[model samples]
Target: GAGAETALLLGLPIATLALIVKNIYNGMFIPLLCHKADAYAEVGDTRGIERMHLISGIGLSLTLGIIVTVSYLAGVNMVKGFLDAIPEFIKHGLSVATGIIPALGFAMLARLLINKKVAPYFFLGFVLMAYLKIPVTGIAILGAIVAVVMVNMPKFAASQPAPAQGASHDDEDDF
Candidate 1:
């Protein structure tokens, strides 16, 4: 009863706040932060951009809503069946872990998106850790280390000088 009452009281306000934040971020922050040429060229004007953002936001919410609803129902059924079949100790372990996996997934996605350097190797390392049966704590440490190392790798090639126009080189002659 408390949970239901709380959800009833807070849900609408929370949803409203989320929509406001989404609109502000999409309309103002993203445009300012993204490449000016790309944003303006694609959207044409503020009104057009706003419309695009609104449509996209609605579509994304609709899609995610359907997916999450289905997943939650399926998970509930599967978890119920599992609890019935499994030993008490294993059921308890799984019950505890069910609360953790979503948070872990969110953290992983945030890390990958915010730190582009780690994005490439993060999934690969995750697969390797899972397949190799590495302990969860070990996987977390290794993931962090790999992400840091990848993020800090030098951009030496980007800083290299370009050849001058009309400059002749032996490599070019050979080609």
Candidate 2:
């Protein structure tokens, strides 16, 4: 909903709008179909499961096809104008939520990935991007290099020869 609202607010190109619509349709409808399919599976109805898959596949394809066809026929301007009647506050709220969506996604991902060992590097990348203004590609490359070096460090240490077992260290012997 926020995505669709954002699309309408920004008046994105037809392709982006159509993609957003398709994604929304899948996100809403696919899970519903899956839930029903699960119930059918519990009853051992294999045909129902097959039918559900067929319906979902064809429904999504047709939805995308229809959206593309109708939007092209109607023109983007009409679609853009279609949202003009909505209240300003609702649009503003959706815009704010859309802005926060990326941060929320990153936070969820970090919850899964940010363990003690990984925390320092995660913050390092954040600082590089947020404060140092380095691009993501540069940070990713740096991370890869660091990871390679860290992984091979133990091997490098192991390759070095050990000291002699009974080396004399007396001062008189040295003199």
Candidate 3:
């Protein structure tokens, strides 16, 4: 019981940290990249970013709210039943992990509002960290680099015109 309580306590801070890191990576960095790539113009004013933030925040809250509600209704009893069938340690671990899901959802919503590119990185990083047991910080850094590189590479490729596009009819016939 004491261990479970302690774990729940620890999970709060870890979840908060995870939320903060995810928000910064998605909301700030990815948006900057998108702006640079001309995928979307700068909000033009602080109000615009604020408006986007408000709209996105509300949208995210509504979506997650529904998901959480459904999960509680459909999953709580099922999970309890499953946990009852499992070992005590596993049940404890699952309970602790479940508390972090809300924070993770919030972080995901914040990112989605500001930068859509973050979803893939978040999912991939989450899979790598949770399943593959990769270091979270390292994977986060790697994901950032990969996102930046991938976002910019297409721009670089697009800047180079094909020779065929520049060739005259005579040159085309010669080829």
* Per-prediction TM-score to the true structure, in the order listed: 0.26, 0.63, 0.32
**Candidate 1 residue runs with Cα over 4 Å from true position:** 1-122, 154-175
Task: Spell out the clash pairs found in candidate 1.
Answer: none
Give per-residue CA lDDT, model 2, range 23-54, as digits (tens).
57777999999999999999999999999999
Candidate 3 residue-wise lDDT, 49-99, digit = tens = 555566556655565455445544554455345335657785475567668
Residues 19-125 of candidate 1 have per-residue lDDT tens digits of: 44454456675565445535755757776556656666675576556544553445444434433564678546555765786999988878667567656656766
| Pairs that clash in candidate 2 | none
Between candidates 1 and 3, name the one with more favorable TM-score. 3
| Model 2, residue 114: C-alpha shift (Å) | 1.5
Q: Kindly state the number of residue pairs that clash in model 2.
A: 0
Number of the top candidate by TM-score?
2
Candidate 1 at residue 134, lDDT? Answer: 78
- All candidates: CA RMSD in angstroms? 15.9, 6.9, 16.2
Deviating ranges (above 4 Å) for candidate 3? 1-118, 165-175
Better model by TM-score, 1 or 2?
2
* Residue runs of model 2 more than 4 Å from their true location after superposition: 1-20, 34-62, 85-93, 159-164, 168-175
How much lDDT does each candidate structure score? 0.60, 0.82, 0.61
